[model samples]
Target: MAEGLFGVHAAALEVRSQRMGVLASNIANASTPNFKARDIDFTTALNAVESQPGGVGADLGGAVKYRVPTNPSMDGNTVELSTEQTAFAENAVQYQSTLAFLNGRIGQITRALKGE
Candidate 1:
Protein backbone atom coordinates (compact mmCIF):
# COMPACT_ATOMS: atom_id res chain seq x y z
CA MET A 1 0.00 0.00 0.00
CA ALA A 2 1.14 3.53 -0.65
CA GLU A 3 0.29 4.13 3.00
CA GLY A 4 2.89 1.60 4.10
CA LEU A 5 5.40 3.27 1.83
CA PHE A 6 4.53 6.69 3.24
CA GLY A 7 6.76 6.41 6.30
CA VAL A 8 9.32 4.42 4.40
CA HIS A 9 12.59 5.88 3.22
CA ALA A 10 11.39 6.16 -0.35
CA ALA A 11 8.27 8.01 0.64
CA ALA A 12 10.14 10.41 2.86
CA LEU A 13 12.57 11.09 0.06
CA GLU A 14 9.72 11.78 -2.34
CA VAL A 15 8.15 14.21 0.07
CA ARG A 16 11.41 16.12 0.39
CA SER A 17 11.61 16.11 -3.35
CA GLN A 18 8.31 17.87 -3.94
CA ARG A 19 9.26 20.33 -1.29
CA MET A 20 12.42 21.02 -3.21
CA GLY A 21 10.42 21.99 -6.24
CA VAL A 22 8.52 24.54 -4.21
CA LEU A 23 11.71 25.98 -2.86
CA ALA A 24 13.18 26.18 -6.30
CA SER A 25 10.20 28.09 -7.55
CA ASN A 26 10.56 30.50 -4.70
CA ILE A 27 14.23 31.03 -5.32
CA ALA A 28 13.79 31.44 -9.04
CA ASN A 29 11.39 34.28 -8.55
CA ALA A 30 13.31 35.96 -5.76
CA SER A 31 14.27 38.89 -7.96
CA THR A 32 10.94 39.35 -9.63
CA PRO A 33 10.33 42.55 -7.67
CA ASN A 34 7.08 41.25 -6.20
CA PHE A 35 7.46 37.52 -6.46
CA LYS A 36 7.08 36.08 -3.00
CA ALA A 37 9.68 33.43 -2.30
CA ARG A 38 7.81 30.31 -1.27
CA ASP A 39 9.17 27.63 1.03
CA ILE A 40 7.41 24.76 2.72
CA ASP A 41 8.21 23.80 6.27
CA PHE A 42 8.97 20.16 5.49
CA THR A 43 8.52 18.75 8.98
CA THR A 44 5.17 20.41 9.39
CA ALA A 45 3.97 19.46 5.95
CA LEU A 46 4.98 15.84 6.46
CA ASN A 47 3.19 15.68 9.75
CA ALA A 48 0.05 17.05 8.16
CA VAL A 49 0.29 14.57 5.36
CA GLU A 50 0.66 11.76 7.86
CA SER A 51 -2.32 12.93 9.81
CA GLN A 52 -4.63 12.23 6.91
CA PRO A 53 -6.17 8.77 7.48
CA GLY A 54 -6.69 7.44 3.98
CA GLY A 55 -3.05 7.01 2.99
CA VAL A 56 0.41 8.51 2.99
CA GLY A 57 2.01 10.84 0.41
CA ALA A 58 -1.46 11.24 -0.99
CA ASP A 59 -2.11 14.59 0.57
CA LEU A 60 -0.38 17.42 -1.23
CA GLY A 61 1.52 20.09 0.64
CA GLY A 62 -0.64 21.12 3.59
CA ALA A 63 0.12 24.82 3.91
CA VAL A 64 2.73 27.03 2.37
CA LYS A 65 4.05 29.97 4.32
CA TYR A 66 4.82 32.62 1.74
CA ARG A 67 8.04 34.09 2.93
CA VAL A 68 7.27 37.61 4.05
CA PRO A 69 8.75 40.17 1.74
CA THR A 70 11.22 41.48 4.23
CA ASN A 71 12.49 43.71 1.48
CA PRO A 72 9.76 44.91 -0.71
CA SER A 73 10.73 45.12 -4.38
CA MET A 74 10.01 48.23 -6.39
CA ASP A 75 9.65 46.22 -9.61
CA GLY A 76 7.33 43.53 -8.18
CA ASN A 77 9.60 40.75 -9.39
CA THR A 78 11.00 38.48 -6.68
CA VAL A 79 12.62 35.62 -8.50
CA GLU A 80 16.19 34.73 -7.66
CA LEU A 81 16.79 32.73 -10.80
CA SER A 82 20.19 31.24 -10.11
CA THR A 83 19.44 30.13 -6.59
CA GLU A 84 16.12 28.61 -7.58
CA GLN A 85 17.67 26.72 -10.49
CA THR A 86 20.34 25.21 -8.33
CA ALA A 87 17.84 24.07 -5.75
CA PHE A 88 15.56 22.69 -8.44
CA ALA A 89 18.33 20.72 -10.04
CA GLU A 90 19.43 19.19 -6.78
CA ASN A 91 15.90 18.24 -5.87
CA ALA A 92 15.37 16.72 -9.31
CA VAL A 93 18.38 14.50 -8.94
CA GLN A 94 17.28 13.29 -5.54
CA TYR A 95 13.79 12.64 -6.82
CA GLN A 96 15.18 10.61 -9.70
CA SER A 97 17.37 8.55 -7.41
CA THR A 98 14.48 7.73 -5.13
CA LEU A 99 12.31 6.80 -8.09
CA ALA A 100 14.99 4.45 -9.33
CA PHE A 101 15.13 2.74 -5.98
CA LEU A 102 11.40 2.28 -5.90
CA ASN A 103 11.46 0.87 -9.41
CA GLY A 104 14.11 -1.63 -8.44
CA ARG A 105 11.99 -2.73 -5.51
CA ILE A 106 9.01 -3.26 -7.77
CA GLY A 107 11.16 -5.28 -10.14
CA GLN A 108 12.27 -7.51 -7.32
CA ILE A 109 8.68 -8.07 -6.30
CA THR A 110 7.82 -9.00 -9.86
CA ARG A 111 10.65 -11.51 -10.00
CA ALA A 112 9.44 -13.10 -6.80
CA LEU A 113 5.93 -13.37 -8.18
CA LYS A 114 7.22 -15.01 -11.30
CA GLY A 115 9.21 -17.49 -9.27
CA GLU A 116 6.16 -18.37 -7.21
Candidate 2:
Protein backbone atom coordinates (compact mmCIF):
# COMPACT_ATOMS: atom_id res chain seq x y z
CA MET A 1 0.00 0.00 0.00
CA ALA A 2 2.80 2.39 0.92
CA GLU A 3 4.66 1.48 -2.22
CA GLY A 4 1.59 2.15 -4.31
CA LEU A 5 1.05 5.46 -2.60
CA PHE A 6 4.62 6.69 -2.93
CA GLY A 7 5.44 5.10 -6.28
CA VAL A 8 9.01 5.89 -7.43
CA HIS A 9 9.69 8.70 -4.97
CA ALA A 10 10.94 6.27 -2.34
CA ALA A 11 13.34 4.62 -4.74
CA ALA A 12 14.46 8.02 -5.99
CA LEU A 13 15.15 9.13 -2.41
CA GLU A 14 17.22 6.03 -1.81
CA VAL A 15 19.28 6.64 -4.92
CA ARG A 16 19.79 10.29 -4.07
CA SER A 17 20.87 9.39 -0.54
CA GLN A 18 23.35 6.85 -1.85
CA ARG A 19 24.66 9.35 -4.40
CA MET A 20 25.24 11.91 -1.64
CA GLY A 21 27.38 9.41 0.25
CA VAL A 22 29.42 8.62 -2.84
CA LEU A 23 29.96 12.30 -3.60
CA ALA A 24 30.87 13.06 0.02
CA SER A 25 33.36 10.22 -0.01
CA ASN A 26 34.94 11.68 -3.09
CA ILE A 27 35.28 15.07 -1.39
CA ALA A 28 36.74 13.47 1.73
CA ASN A 29 39.34 11.56 -0.32
CA ALA A 30 40.21 14.51 -2.53
CA SER A 31 43.82 14.58 -1.33
CA THR A 32 44.33 10.85 -1.04
CA PRO A 33 46.77 9.64 -3.70
CA ASN A 34 45.37 7.42 -6.43
CA PHE A 35 41.90 7.60 -4.91
CA LYS A 36 39.56 7.20 -7.83
CA ALA A 37 36.45 9.34 -7.28
CA ARG A 38 33.32 7.29 -7.79
CA ASP A 39 29.71 8.23 -8.51
CA ILE A 40 26.47 6.60 -9.46
CA ASP A 41 24.65 7.15 -12.72
CA PHE A 42 21.42 8.36 -11.13
CA THR A 43 19.11 8.00 -14.11
CA THR A 44 20.34 4.53 -14.87
CA ALA A 45 20.01 3.44 -11.27
CA LEU A 46 16.49 4.83 -10.99
CA ASN A 47 15.49 3.10 -14.20
CA ALA A 48 16.92 -0.15 -12.88
CA VAL A 49 14.86 0.22 -9.72
CA GLU A 50 11.66 0.91 -11.62
CA SER A 51 12.22 -2.04 -13.91
CA GLN A 52 12.59 -4.46 -11.03
CA PRO A 53 9.64 -6.41 -9.60
CA GLY A 54 9.48 -4.64 -6.26
CA GLY A 55 11.17 -1.40 -7.32
CA VAL A 56 12.88 -1.58 -3.93
CA GLY A 57 16.09 -3.06 -2.58
CA ALA A 58 17.54 -2.78 -6.07
CA ASP A 59 21.32 -3.19 -6.21
CA LEU A 60 22.86 0.14 -7.21
CA GLY A 61 26.44 -1.04 -7.04
CA GLY A 62 26.49 -1.72 -10.76
CA ALA A 63 25.67 1.92 -11.49
CA VAL A 64 28.71 3.23 -9.58
CA LYS A 65 31.74 4.06 -11.73
CA TYR A 66 35.07 5.78 -11.29
CA ARG A 67 35.08 9.36 -12.51
CA VAL A 68 37.64 10.35 -15.09
CA PRO A 69 39.43 13.47 -14.03
CA THR A 70 39.38 16.47 -16.35
CA ASN A 71 43.05 17.07 -15.68
CA PRO A 72 45.00 14.19 -14.29
CA SER A 73 46.68 14.91 -10.99
CA MET A 74 50.39 14.27 -10.49
CA ASP A 75 49.59 12.11 -7.48
CA GLY A 76 47.05 10.11 -9.54
CA ASN A 77 44.13 11.14 -7.35
CA THR A 78 41.08 11.43 -9.56
CA VAL A 79 39.12 13.50 -7.07
CA GLU A 80 38.86 17.19 -7.87
CA LEU A 81 37.66 19.06 -4.81
CA SER A 82 35.63 21.63 -6.68
CA THR A 83 33.88 19.08 -8.85
CA GLU A 84 33.19 16.80 -5.93
CA GLN A 85 31.79 19.62 -3.85
CA THR A 86 29.50 20.73 -6.65
CA ALA A 87 28.22 17.21 -7.20
CA PHE A 88 27.70 16.77 -3.48
CA ALA A 89 25.70 19.96 -3.26
CA GLU A 90 23.57 19.04 -6.26
CA ASN A 91 22.88 15.56 -4.92
CA ALA A 92 22.00 16.96 -1.51
CA VAL A 93 19.42 19.22 -3.09
CA GLN A 94 17.93 16.31 -5.00
CA TYR A 95 17.80 14.21 -1.83
CA GLN A 96 16.00 16.94 0.02
CA SER A 97 13.53 17.38 -2.78
CA THR A 98 12.70 13.70 -2.82
CA LEU A 99 12.29 13.72 0.96
CA ALA A 100 9.90 16.63 0.74
CA PHE A 101 7.81 14.89 -1.90
CA LEU A 102 7.54 11.81 0.26
CA ASN A 103 6.56 13.87 3.29
CA GLY A 104 3.84 15.62 1.33
CA ARG A 105 2.52 12.33 0.04
CA ILE A 106 2.44 10.89 3.56
CA GLY A 107 0.55 13.92 4.81
CA GLN A 108 -2.02 13.51 2.07
CA ILE A 109 -2.49 9.86 2.98
CA THR A 110 -2.87 10.71 6.64
CA ARG A 111 -5.51 13.34 5.88
CA ALA A 112 -7.45 10.92 3.68
CA LEU A 113 -7.38 8.27 6.38
CA LYS A 114 -8.61 10.79 8.94
CA GLY A 115 -11.64 11.62 6.70
CA GLU A 116 -10.42 15.19 6.52
Candidate 3:
Protein backbone atom coordinates (compact mmCIF):
# COMPACT_ATOMS: atom_id res chain seq x y z
CA MET A 1 0.00 0.00 0.00
CA ALA A 2 2.75 2.41 0.89
CA GLU A 3 4.66 1.46 -2.18
CA GLY A 4 1.59 2.03 -4.31
CA LEU A 5 1.07 5.43 -2.76
CA PHE A 6 4.67 6.57 -3.06
CA GLY A 7 5.54 4.78 -6.26
CA VAL A 8 9.07 5.38 -7.58
CA HIS A 9 9.87 8.36 -5.36
CA ALA A 10 10.61 6.13 -2.40
CA ALA A 11 13.16 4.11 -4.26
CA ALA A 12 14.46 7.18 -6.03
CA LEU A 13 14.95 8.91 -2.71
CA GLU A 14 16.99 5.98 -1.50
CA VAL A 15 19.07 5.99 -4.64
CA ARG A 16 19.59 9.75 -4.48
CA SER A 17 20.58 9.48 -0.83
CA GLN A 18 23.12 6.82 -1.63
CA ARG A 19 24.40 8.83 -4.56
CA MET A 20 24.88 11.85 -2.35
CA GLY A 21 27.08 9.78 -0.08
CA VAL A 22 29.16 8.57 -2.99
CA LEU A 23 29.53 12.07 -4.39
CA ALA A 24 30.45 13.46 -0.99
CA SER A 25 33.03 10.76 -0.62
CA ASN A 26 34.56 11.75 -3.91
CA ILE A 27 34.70 15.38 -2.82
CA ALA A 28 36.18 14.37 0.51
CA ASN A 29 38.91 12.35 -1.16
CA ALA A 30 39.79 15.00 -3.73
CA SER A 31 43.29 15.41 -2.35
CA THR A 32 43.94 11.78 -1.48
CA PRO A 33 46.46 10.15 -3.81
CA ASN A 34 45.38 7.06 -5.73
CA PHE A 35 41.78 7.58 -4.65
CA LYS A 36 39.51 6.42 -7.37
CA ALA A 37 36.21 8.26 -7.39
CA ARG A 38 33.05 6.19 -7.57
CA ASP A 39 29.43 6.86 -8.38
CA ILE A 40 26.12 5.09 -8.71
CA ASP A 41 24.37 4.57 -12.00
CA PHE A 42 21.09 6.13 -10.97
CA THR A 43 18.98 4.70 -13.75
CA THR A 44 20.26 1.21 -13.19
CA ALA A 45 19.87 1.45 -9.44
CA LEU A 46 16.33 2.82 -9.74
CA ASN A 47 15.38 0.07 -12.16
CA ALA A 48 16.80 -2.55 -9.85
CA VAL A 49 14.83 -1.12 -6.95
CA GLU A 50 11.56 -0.89 -8.86
CA SER A 51 11.88 -4.46 -10.07
CA GLN A 52 12.07 -5.74 -6.54
CA PRO A 53 8.96 -6.60 -4.56
CA GLY A 54 7.79 -3.47 -2.71
CA GLY A 55 10.97 -1.81 -3.96
CA VAL A 56 12.77 -2.84 -0.81
CA GLY A 57 16.15 -4.41 -0.12
CA ALA A 58 17.46 -3.68 -3.59
CA ASP A 59 21.19 -4.28 -4.00
CA LEU A 60 23.09 -1.26 -5.32
CA GLY A 61 26.43 -3.01 -5.50
CA GLY A 62 26.03 -3.58 -9.21
CA ALA A 63 25.22 0.06 -9.79
CA VAL A 64 28.26 1.52 -8.06
CA LYS A 65 31.21 2.08 -10.38
CA TYR A 66 34.43 4.02 -10.68
CA ARG A 67 34.18 7.37 -12.42
CA VAL A 68 36.61 7.91 -15.25
CA PRO A 69 38.33 11.29 -15.08
CA THR A 70 38.43 13.55 -18.08
CA ASN A 71 42.11 14.22 -17.42
CA PRO A 72 44.28 11.75 -15.63
CA SER A 73 46.02 13.29 -12.64
CA MET A 74 49.69 12.75 -11.85
CA ASP A 75 48.71 11.69 -8.31
CA GLY A 76 46.44 8.93 -9.68
CA ASN A 77 43.40 10.37 -7.98
CA THR A 78 40.32 10.25 -10.17
CA VAL A 79 38.43 12.81 -8.12
CA GLU A 80 38.26 16.10 -9.92
CA LEU A 81 37.05 18.65 -7.43
CA SER A 82 34.97 20.61 -9.91
CA THR A 83 33.38 17.50 -11.36
CA GLU A 84 32.69 16.04 -7.96
CA GLN A 85 31.18 19.31 -6.74
CA THR A 86 28.94 19.58 -9.75
CA ALA A 87 27.75 16.00 -9.40
CA PHE A 88 27.24 16.45 -5.68
CA ALA A 89 25.18 19.59 -6.16
CA GLU A 90 23.07 17.91 -8.81
CA ASN A 91 22.52 14.87 -6.63
CA ALA A 92 21.61 17.06 -3.66
CA VAL A 93 18.97 18.83 -5.71
CA GLN A 94 17.57 15.53 -6.95
CA TYR A 95 17.51 14.13 -3.43
CA GLN A 96 15.61 17.15 -2.16
CA SER A 97 13.14 16.93 -5.01
CA THR A 98 12.46 13.27 -4.31
CA LEU A 99 12.05 13.98 -0.61
CA ALA A 100 9.58 16.75 -1.36
CA PHE A 101 7.53 14.49 -3.56
CA LEU A 102 7.39 11.81 -0.90
CA ASN A 103 6.43 14.32 1.74
CA GLY A 104 3.64 15.69 -0.41
CA ARG A 105 2.34 12.21 -1.10
CA ILE A 106 2.40 11.35 2.57
CA GLY A 107 0.55 14.54 3.41
CA GLN A 108 -2.10 13.72 0.87
CA ILE A 109 -2.49 10.22 2.30
CA THR A 110 -2.77 11.57 5.79
CA ARG A 111 -5.38 14.09 4.76
CA ALA A 112 -7.39 11.41 3.01
CA LEU A 113 -7.24 9.16 6.05
CA LYS A 114 -8.50 12.02 8.21
CA GLY A 115 -11.36 12.77 5.78
CA GLU A 116 -9.92 16.23 5.16
Candidate 4:
Protein backbone atom coordinates (compact mmCIF):
# COMPACT_ATOMS: atom_id res chain seq x y z
CA MET A 1 0.00 0.00 0.00
CA ALA A 2 2.70 2.50 1.02
CA GLU A 3 4.84 1.35 -1.89
CA GLY A 4 2.08 2.07 -4.37
CA LEU A 5 1.48 5.46 -2.79
CA PHE A 6 5.09 6.58 -3.34
CA GLY A 7 5.71 4.79 -6.63
CA VAL A 8 6.49 7.29 -9.36
CA HIS A 9 6.08 10.68 -7.66
CA ALA A 10 8.61 9.79 -4.98
CA ALA A 11 11.26 9.07 -7.58
CA ALA A 12 10.33 12.16 -9.56
CA LEU A 13 10.52 14.34 -6.47
CA GLU A 14 13.97 13.06 -5.61
CA VAL A 15 15.19 13.70 -9.14
CA ARG A 16 13.74 17.20 -9.15
CA SER A 17 15.31 18.01 -5.80
CA GLN A 18 18.67 16.72 -6.99
CA ARG A 19 18.37 18.78 -10.15
CA MET A 20 17.58 21.86 -8.09
CA GLY A 21 20.73 21.33 -6.06
CA VAL A 22 22.81 20.93 -9.19
CA LEU A 23 21.33 24.05 -10.72
CA ALA A 24 21.94 25.97 -7.51
CA SER A 25 25.55 24.82 -7.51
CA ASN A 26 25.93 25.95 -11.09
CA ILE A 27 24.46 29.37 -10.27
CA ALA A 28 26.65 29.75 -7.19
CA ASN A 29 29.80 29.01 -9.21
CA ALA A 30 28.90 31.18 -12.19
CA SER A 31 31.67 33.64 -11.37
CA THR A 32 34.31 31.04 -10.57
CA PRO A 33 36.95 30.36 -13.17
CA ASN A 34 36.74 27.07 -15.06
CA PHE A 35 33.81 25.85 -13.04
CA LYS A 36 31.82 23.46 -15.15
CA ALA A 37 28.08 23.41 -14.58
CA ARG A 38 26.46 20.08 -13.81
CA ASP A 39 22.92 18.68 -13.97
CA ILE A 40 21.01 15.42 -13.86
CA ASP A 41 19.10 13.64 -16.58
CA PHE A 42 15.76 13.62 -14.81
CA THR A 43 14.05 11.09 -17.03
CA THR A 44 16.85 8.60 -16.83
CA ALA A 45 17.25 8.95 -13.08
CA LEU A 46 13.54 8.74 -12.44
CA ASN A 47 13.23 5.71 -14.64
CA ALA A 48 16.06 3.96 -12.87
CA VAL A 49 14.51 4.55 -9.48
CA GLU A 50 11.00 3.69 -10.54
CA SER A 51 12.15 0.45 -12.10
CA GLN A 52 13.43 -0.69 -8.74
CA PRO A 53 11.16 -2.61 -6.38
CA GLY A 54 11.75 -0.25 -3.47
CA GLY A 55 10.46 3.27 -3.86
CA VAL A 56 13.22 5.78 -4.48
CA GLY A 57 14.28 7.99 -1.62
CA ALA A 58 16.73 10.92 -1.66
CA ASP A 59 19.68 9.04 -3.12
CA LEU A 60 20.58 10.72 -6.41
CA GLY A 61 24.34 11.16 -6.55
CA GLY A 62 25.08 8.98 -9.59
CA ALA A 63 22.64 10.71 -11.93
CA VAL A 64 24.65 13.94 -12.18
CA LYS A 65 26.22 14.98 -15.48
CA TYR A 66 27.94 18.01 -16.99
CA ARG A 67 25.86 20.53 -18.86
CA VAL A 68 26.78 21.43 -22.43
CA PRO A 69 27.12 25.19 -22.61
CA THR A 70 25.51 27.07 -25.48
CA ASN A 71 28.06 29.85 -25.14
CA PRO A 72 31.43 28.72 -23.97
CA SER A 73 33.25 31.14 -21.68
CA MET A 74 36.84 32.21 -22.24
CA ASP A 75 37.76 30.97 -18.79
CA GLY A 76 36.37 27.48 -19.62
CA ASN A 77 33.54 27.97 -17.15
CA THR A 78 30.25 26.47 -18.33
CA VAL A 79 28.09 28.01 -15.62
CA GLU A 80 25.64 30.34 -17.33
CA LEU A 81 23.94 32.32 -14.60
CA SER A 82 20.69 33.00 -16.41
CA THR A 83 20.28 29.45 -17.66
CA GLU A 84 21.11 28.04 -14.26
CA GLN A 85 18.63 30.36 -12.59
CA THR A 86 15.91 29.34 -15.02
CA ALA A 87 16.57 25.65 -14.56
CA PHE A 88 16.65 26.08 -10.80
CA ALA A 89 13.33 27.87 -10.80
CA GLU A 90 11.72 25.24 -13.00
CA ASN A 91 13.06 22.39 -10.90
CA ALA A 92 11.85 24.07 -7.72
CA VAL A 93 8.36 24.31 -9.12
CA GLN A 94 8.42 20.65 -10.14
CA TYR A 95 9.68 19.66 -6.71
CA GLN A 96 6.83 21.55 -5.08
CA SER A 97 4.30 19.90 -7.35
CA THR A 98 5.63 16.44 -6.55
CA LEU A 99 5.55 17.28 -2.86
CA ALA A 100 1.95 18.35 -3.15
CA PHE A 101 1.03 15.12 -4.86
CA LEU A 102 2.74 13.10 -2.16
CA ASN A 103 0.96 15.08 0.53
CA GLY A 104 -2.38 14.52 -1.16
CA ARG A 105 -1.68 10.81 -1.42
CA ILE A 106 -0.84 10.68 2.27
CA GLY A 107 -4.00 12.55 3.14
CA GLN A 108 -6.09 10.14 1.12
CA ILE A 109 -4.44 7.20 2.79
CA THR A 110 -5.02 8.71 6.22
CA ARG A 111 -8.68 9.37 5.45
CA ALA A 112 -9.18 5.87 4.16
CA LEU A 113 -7.56 4.34 7.24
CA LYS A 114 -9.87 6.38 9.46
CA GLY A 115 -12.86 5.15 7.41
CA GLU A 116 -13.92 8.75 6.86
Candidate with maximal TM-score? 3
In terms of TM-score, which candidate is stronger, 2 or 4?
2
lDDT of 4 at 80: 82
What tens-digit string does per-residue lDDT give for candidate 2 at 44-65?
A: 8998777777766778878999
Q: Give the clashing pairs for model 4.
A: none
Model 4 alpha-carbon drift over 4 Å, by segment: 52-62
**Residue 113 shift from truth in candidate 4, angstroms:** 1.1
Residues 18-65, model 1: lDDT tens digits: 678688668656655556776666677666666666434555655566
CA deviation > 4 Å runs, candidate 3 = 53-57
Each candidate's number of clashing pairs is 22, 0, 0, 0
lDDT of 4 by residue, 7-79 (tens): 7787788678768777888888998999999999887788767766664464555677899999999999999
* TM-scores vs. true structure, each candidate: 0.65, 0.91, 0.92, 0.87
Which window of ten consecutive residues has the lowest lDDT sum in model 2? 49-58
**Shift of residue 103 alpha carbon in model 2, Å:** 0.4
Arranged by TM-score with the best first, the candidates are 3, 2, 4, 1
**All candidates' lDDT scores?**
0.64, 0.87, 0.89, 0.82
